[model samples]
Target chain A: MVTETSLSPIATFHSARRGRYEVAHQGVLALGEGTIVVEPGHNFEQGLQGLKGFDRLWLVYLFHLNQTEDAPPVMVKPPRFEHKVGVFATRSPHRPNPIGITPARLLHVAGRMLTVAQADLLDQTPIVDIKPYLPFCDAFPEAAVGWGGLAPTPYRLLWSEGARERVAEIASAHDLRLDHYAEVQLQLDPTDTSRKRIRATEQGFALDFREWSLHYEVRGEAQEVWIEQVTERPEFPGPSSLK
Target chain B: MVTETSLSPIATFHSARRGRYEVAHQGVLALGEGTIVVEPGHNFEQGLQGLKGFDRLWLVYLFHLNQTEDAPPVMVKPPRFEHKVGVFATRSPHRPNPIGITPARLLHVAGRMLTVAQADLLDQTPIVDIKPYLPFCDAFPEAAVGWGGLAPTPYRLLWSEGARERVAEIASAHDLRLDHYAEVQLQLDPTDTSRKRIRATEQGFALDFREWSLHYEVRGEAQEVWIEQVTERPEFPGPSSLK
Candidate 1:
C-alpha cells in the first residue's frame, strides 16, 4: 500500500520538437534527431559505460506539459480510431501517472551526452531512466492488437502553396507547429468533429489552434485532405477587455 | 531544470513470484501468471476499457525491493555477459529512478482486475502505468543488441531425486525459491564467482542461499550442471548472536 514515490531527473532531452504538437505519434515516425545530456556529479558517466554498443535505447520520461490539475479523463479518443477508448488503451499523456516510455535509435554516445534519432520527445523533457533495448525481450512483431491493428484509411495530406508558406510563417512567428499537429489530428479521422476542434464551413472544414485555424477539405472517399489556407481567428471581447 | 515529481500507484500486481530471485529476466521467460488490481474510487475501470483487445500490455512499475540507500553502482555484470557493463546498458533494478517496464501476455480483464501471464514481477509490485502494446510502434525484432546479443553457452540444469525433494522441502519450510534462483544465476555462467554467490568446494561447487546451500558440479565442457544435494550451512556466531 505504497502511497507515493518521488523521482528526480537524471538527464534532459534536447530536441527541435518544442511542444507536444510537434512530436510524432511514434518515435519511428519522428523525422529529426535529439540529444540527451545526463546531469553531472553523480557518476552517471560510469552508468553510461558500454551503452553505446546498443542500436536502440528506451527512455523513461515524464509528461511535464500536462497542465490539468484535476483527475485525467478515463476515456480518450485516439486520433487513429473512431471510438473513444480507455486511457490505458491509448498512448495519451493524460494518465494516472503521466509517464512515457519511448525507444530511440542510438547514433553515438560521448561522455555524459548521447545523440539519438527518431525520438518523439519535446525540448527539455526530463528523462528519469534509460535502458539498452534487448531485441529478444523487447520486440514482438507478431503480437496482436485488436482495434488498433485495424487502422482506418489514412488521408493523404496535401498542403497548398499558400498553406505551406503560412505554416512556415506560423512556425517562425509563434514557435507553433501547426503542420505536424494537423498531420497528427487530421490524417486518420478527417471528418470527426466530435472530439476534434473542427467544424464545417462554407468551403469545407476548419481546424482551430488557439488564435489560428487551418482550413481544409476532404476529397474522394475522404482519402485526400487538402489544406487550402491558414488564417488568424477573429478576436472577440473577453473578461480582460470588460475590466 | 525540474527537480522531482511525485507519483502514486494506480494498481498493484499479485504474483506467485514473491521475490526478485523467483522472477525471470524477461516476461516471456517467466513460468506463471499474475493479476493486476487497479485501485478503486479512481475511475480506473473506465481507464481499462478496450485494453482487453490488446494481446500484450506494457506495465510500468517500481523496483520496490531495492534496499540500498546509497547511490547504485554505475557498472554491473549481467548474467549472460562476462564483462561488466554500464547500469544503463542492463536491466538492473538498482537505478537512479528504480523504474521498470515489461510487456506481458494479456489473459483477461474483468472489471478493475487484469489477468496477465508471463509477467516478471514480484508479488505486490506497484504498477504506475499500463499501455496496450502496439506492435507497429513497440516491435523491432531486427534491432541490434551489442554484448547482450552474444549470449554464452547455457548450462543444462539437472537435479537428482534427492535434491528435488530437498528443494521442495525447503520451499515448503522457508518459503524461499531456491530452485528458480539457481536457474537464473547458474544457467548462463555456471562457475562465474566474480558476481554470483558461487564457491568451489571439495566435491563440486556450492551456491549460498542464506542458511542453506546448493551443491552441484559442472559436467563436460561446462555445458551441464548437476545439483547433487541441498544442505544447511554450518552455524556460525553472527552479529545477532554476539549482541
Candidate 2:
C-alpha cells in the first residue's frame, strides 16, 4: 500500500578501498579503515551525542556502484559459493533496493566525523543511517547460518620476505592494493580456478593480476596460503616499469 | 555527490500488531508473528530459495507511518532514556532515510511467502529487502550497548483469572488486543505515568486504554506487575453491552 520512497545521503565514507576487487565481500574481513563525515547545517552533532559510548555501530549505506537499470537478477553467484543462490539469500549489492548494512567497529567519534575499522564500503560511498549496535537485540550467536555455513573456511594468508618487498614496491609505485586483492580473492577457496584468475603452476599456484602475478602454495592441512613470490608478466610491461 | 535515490517495495508484511502503540520498540520483544508476501511477477520465488535454511533473517522495511515531510529531528527521546539522544544513537523510526532493519526468527518459507516471529512491523508495511542473518558477520555479544545497557530491566506480567477472562471477552467481542498492548507498554516501565495514561487508584495503579481500564499493582522487589482486573469505564457504554 506504499509508493516508491526517496532517500538522501547524510554522510560520506572516505576509505582507501577504491575498487570492488580491493574490498572484501564481508565487512568483518575488510582490514581497511574508513571515516564517515556527516554533513553540517543539520543538528547531526547533537544526534551523535551518545553514539561514541558504543563500541560498534550499524551503518546503513547505499550501494552507489550498482549500475544495473533493469531488475536485479533473481539469482546471484556468491564468490564463496559454487552454485548460484537466490539474491535474497546472499548479501549481494544488486537488489530491488540497492542498500547495505554493515556493523563497523567504532573507533572514534569527533563531532560530525566518525572513524570506523573493518568497513567494506568503497571510497565516497553515501551513508544513510547510523545506529548503535545493541548486543541484546542484534546478536544471535546460536542462530544457524544455513547455506553460509557450508562455505569453505578462510585460509590464513602468509607472505614471504621476497613477496612482501615486491608487493610493497608495487603498492607504493602504482597505488594498487595487490596484497589486499590477493587476500580478498584467495583467503577462501584459494584453488578455485573457476572463479579466480588462478592456475596450476609447477611449484604450487599462480594468481594473475592485471600485469603482475602472485605465486602461492596452499597448505591445506594447516589451512594457510603462503605467497612465495610476486612478479610482473614478461610480455606485459606495467606503468611502474615504464616509469 | 550522489543525488536522491528511489526504491520500490518488493514485499508486503502482514502482522496483527496494527498500531504504533501495539508494536514493541525492539523486534525481539514484539512476541507476534508476521508473514512477508513477496510481490509476484518479479521472479521473487527464485530469490527466496535457500533462505528457509537460515534460522534468522534481517528484514529491511520502510517506516510508512512516518508522515513528516521535512528532515527528521537530529535528536529523539528514547522511551528507555530520560534525556534526548541523537536520532542515530537510538533505533528511532523517525530518520532521514526512514528505513529500518530488524533481525527476526525465521519460522517458515514457502514459495514467495516467509513467516517470521517477533517482528516489530505494522500490518501491510512495505518490505524492501530480506537477507539471511549470518551470525559471524552480525553477532557482537560483548559490544557495549552504551545508553541502552543502562535501561531498566523488564517486569514480568502476571494476569489474574478474572482479568484474563475479561480480557479474552473484550478481545473476542471487539477484536482488540488489550493483552498484547499491555505487554508492549508495561514490560519496560509500568509505573511511569508521564508517557502512559496511568493514574493511581485506591487499590493499585490503573492504565487507561480507550474506554477500558486495566488495574495492576507493581511488585518492585519481584520485578512483576500483577493485573488484578479489567473494567470498562462507568461513563462509557460498550458495544458489547448494546449487543
Candidate 3:
C-alpha cells in the first residue's frame, strides 16, 4: 500500500443563527433572520463580489443536525421516492457525510455577507464553501433526467380556513414578502413526472405533482405558504422538527 | 432547531477480503479496496454493453487505509508542496473521510473478478461504487493545472546492478512486460520534480516519498519494490490528513 499523508483546515466556520454563518476565512457570513450582511467591505467583497455577477451559486454546507454514529446508507428512499429507490440514487438528507449542496440564486452581497434568494436550507446552516455557477460547466442544457423524469406540471395551492391567516401572520412576523412568482415557482416540481394527490395534518393542504406529495401550511393572514413537508404519500410520517 | 432524526444505517457494503462497511446516508466514508472489470468499448456507445469494449476502465477508489477516529484538519502539507501547503489544498489521505480517488486502467474482467493495470491500493480495498465515465462530462479540454502544473517532465530510470535482471524475472513470472515505460512511469514522477530520491541500500534502494518511506526488495533476482512503513515524518510534521 502506498503510504499516505494528512491535511489541515485553512478556515473555520461558526454558526451564528439560522440562515446565517460566520466563516473565519478573513470575513464572516452574517446571516440575519431575513437579510445577510458581511462586515468589513474588503473581506466581504473579496469573497462575494464576483458572485454578484453570477445568476446562481453553489452552496456547500454541513448537515450539522444529521450527525450520528450510524453508518451511512448506500441507498436512500428520498422524501419523494417514498422508499422505493436506493439512497445513492436519491438526494436524501441521510448520507455517509451530510454534506449538503444547493444551487441558489445570488441575490446580492454586501461586504462579507451574501443575500441569497431561493435557498431551501434552514437558517444558520454552516456554510462550508461556495462557488459561482457557470452555465457552461454547471448547467446541462439537454441532460436526461434519471428515474425522476421531466419536471412535473405546475399546481395551485388551496389553503384551508386558518391556513391563509397563519401564513400572513408568519410573514408579518418575519418581515418578508409572501406574494411573489418566485415563491410560487419554488413550489413547482423540479423533479418527478406523474401527478398525484396527497394530504397531511402539519401542512394545511396537500397536492401531488408527479411522485411527490407537497405539503403546504399557509399562514392565511400573512398571505404566505410555508412548505411543512414533502413526501411520496400524504400518509407518510412527518419528519421530526427538533426546534 | 429542527427536530433531529434518528440516525440509521442506510446501506451496508460487503467484501470477502475487506471488513464489512455499514454506511448511512450522509455518514462518514472509510476507504477499502475492490476490483473493477473493464470491457472493451468506445465512448459513443451507451449502457453496460459498451463498457465491455475498453481493455481497462479507470477505478476511482477510496483511500480508506489511513482513516482514524480524529477530527479532520483544515489544511495539509502535500509532499508535492514540500510540506508547506495546507491540508485542504493538498490531496492528502488524512482528511475527515480519508477518501482517495484514483484512475486505474482496467485490464480484463473474468466473471466478477477484474485484473487491472497497476493500482496503488492494497490487496482488498472495498469498492464503493462504479460508473461508466462519460468523456463529455469527465474530460476538460482546456483545464488549467495549478502548483505542480500539468503532467510532469519525462525521465528514464537508471537501475543499479541486478535491478534490470530482477525486472526480467518478475516479467517472466507474471507473463508480462515489466521493464518498459509502463513500469517506469508508474514508479517515478514523469516530471522528475518529486523531491524523493532513491539511494542504493543493503537490500536494494530506499526513498522518502513524504508520508511513507519505501524500500525495494529483490524478487527472484529481479528488483521489485516492496512497501516498508507508512509513518509520519518528524522533520516535516505536516498537517493531519483528514479535514
Candidate 4:
C-alpha cells in the first residue's frame, strides 16, 4: 500500500461569496469582484514578491465544500448532460480526491495579497500550491473538447428601463453585483434552461440571483433575453425606499 | 483560522521510475514516455468513459517526496535563481501544501487505462484529481511571466557512436530512459547553470542522472552539449558485453 502525505493550506482566498458554485464560467473573468485575492500566510507572503511579472498562474486548491468521509462517487451527472459519466470524465467536485485546479491571471500583487482573475474556486478555499503558467507547456487550443463541446448559442441581454431601476434598488440594498449577475446569467445563453439561474417562464425565462428573481422574455430564435419584470422575495424585506 | 478539508488520492501512477525527480521536461514530449497511464480505482474506472474526445487534462497530485512533519518554508531558492523568494513566487516543491499540478495531453483511452502525455511528475505519484483541459478557459499564451520570463537557450545533444552504444548497454542493465535523459538534458538551454543535471568539468561540463556521469563539451556560444565521454561508476556494474 502507498503512504499518503499530509498537508496544510499555505494561503486562503477572499472572494464575493461561497457555496454550491453552479456556474462553470470557465475562469472567464480574471478581474474585478470576480477577482480572487490570495493572501499568503505569515512568512509566506514573500512568495508573492516576483509573481507580478507572470501573466498567468495555476491555482492548486482543495475542494473544501465537497469533502465527505466516504469513498467518492465514480459517476456524476454534469450540469448540461443528463446521463451519468465517470467522475474522472467530469469536473464535478464529488471525486475520489477532492482537489481543485484552475488557471488564473495574476492581476497584481500587494504585500501579502495577490489579486487574480478567472478563478474557479470557492471563497476561503485552501490553496495547495501556485505555479507559474508556462505557455509552451500548458496551452493546447486546438485540442478537441470531450462531451463538453458545443458553445451555447449567443443571447443578447436586454433590460428594460424599469427592470434596470428595480435591479439597481435591489443592488443598493443587498450589495449584490446585479450587473455581473445579469451578464453571467442572461448574456451567456438565457434560453438554455440547462444553465444555472435560468428557468422557464410564461412569456420567456426567469433568472435567479440570491434573493432577487428577474423575469425576462426570449425573443425570436431565443436570441435575446428581454428582461420584463424584476422582484424580490417577500421573505427577505427590501429597503424602506422600495416599500 | 479557517478549517481545511482533508483529501485522499483517487488513483496511483505507474511510470518508468520513482523517487527524486531531478528533471523538468516541461511536457515537451507530450507524445511518448511523456504518455502516462491513469487507472481509476474501484468503480472509478467507469468515470473515464467518453473522455477521449478531449485533447488535454489537468493532473493534481501530492508532492510526496517533499512532505515532512514540520512547517514549510516561506522562502524558496528556485533552480534558476539563487535568491530566496516568497514560497508563492517560486514553483518549489518545499511548500506549506506539498501539491503538484501539471497539464497534459489525452492521447488515447482504452478501458480503464488512459495514456496521458507531457507530465512533469515522478513515477508512482499519487493523483488527487483529474479534470478535462478546456482550452478556452485554461490557455493564456500572451500572459506575461514574472521572474521566470526568459526562455532557456536551445542546445543540441550530440553523442558519439561509442557513447550511444555504452548508454544502450547501461540503460538495458539499469532500466534507465536514456533517450528521455538525453532529450531533457540536451534540448534545454545548456548555458544556464540553473537547470538540473549540470556540473563544471575539467574541460567543459558533466551532466549527472541517477548513477551515471556524462562528460560533454559546450561550444564557444554554449550552444551545444557535445557528449564526448560516457562512463559509469565502477561501483555500478555494467553489462558484461560492455567489457
Listed for each candidate, the true contacts retained, as a fraction, are 0.79, 0.85, 0.00, 0.69
DockQ, every prediction: 0.67, 0.70, 0.03, 0.55
Query: For candidate 3 chain A, which ten residues in a row score worst on lDDT?
Result: A20-29
Q: Which candidate number would show the highest lDDT if scored against the true structure?
A: 2
Interface RMSDs of all predictions?
A: 1.4, 1.5, 11.7, 2.1
Please, what are the lDDT tens digits per residue for candidate 1 over residues B1-243? 678998889999998677677787777667678999999999998899988778899999998887344688888887656788889988888888889999999999999999998788989899999998888877888888877754345577899999999989988987877888887777666776665468899998998877778899999675899999999878633423211
In order, what lDDT does every prediction score? 0.83, 0.86, 0.38, 0.67
Specify the highest-DockQ model's number: 2
Order the candidates by lDDT, highest first. 2, 1, 4, 3
The segments of candidate 2 whose C-alpha lies over 4 angstroms from its true place after superposition are A150-152, A235-243, B150-152, B172-175, B234-243
Give the Å error, residue B180, model 2: 2.3
> Residue-wise lDDT of candidate 1 within A122-235, one digit each (tens)?
899999999988877788888889766543455778999999999999889877788888876776677777644788889999988877789999995758999999987786
Alpha-carbon shift of residue A61 in model 1 (angstroms): 0.8
- Alpha-carbon RMSD to native, per candidate: 4.2, 3.7, 13.9, 5.3
TM-score of 3: 0.40
Clashing pairs in 2: A47-B86
lDDT of 3 at B45: 14
- The list of candidate 3 runs beyond 4 A from truth reads A1-83, A96-121, A124-243, B1-63, B68-75, B79-83, B96-165, B168-188, B191-194, B198-243
| Better model by lDDT: candidate 1 vs candidate 4 | 1
Where in model 1 is the C-alpha error above 4 Å? A149-163, A190-243, B67-70, B80-82, B149-158, B191-196, B199-206, B215-228, B231-243
* Clash-forming residue pairs, model 1: none
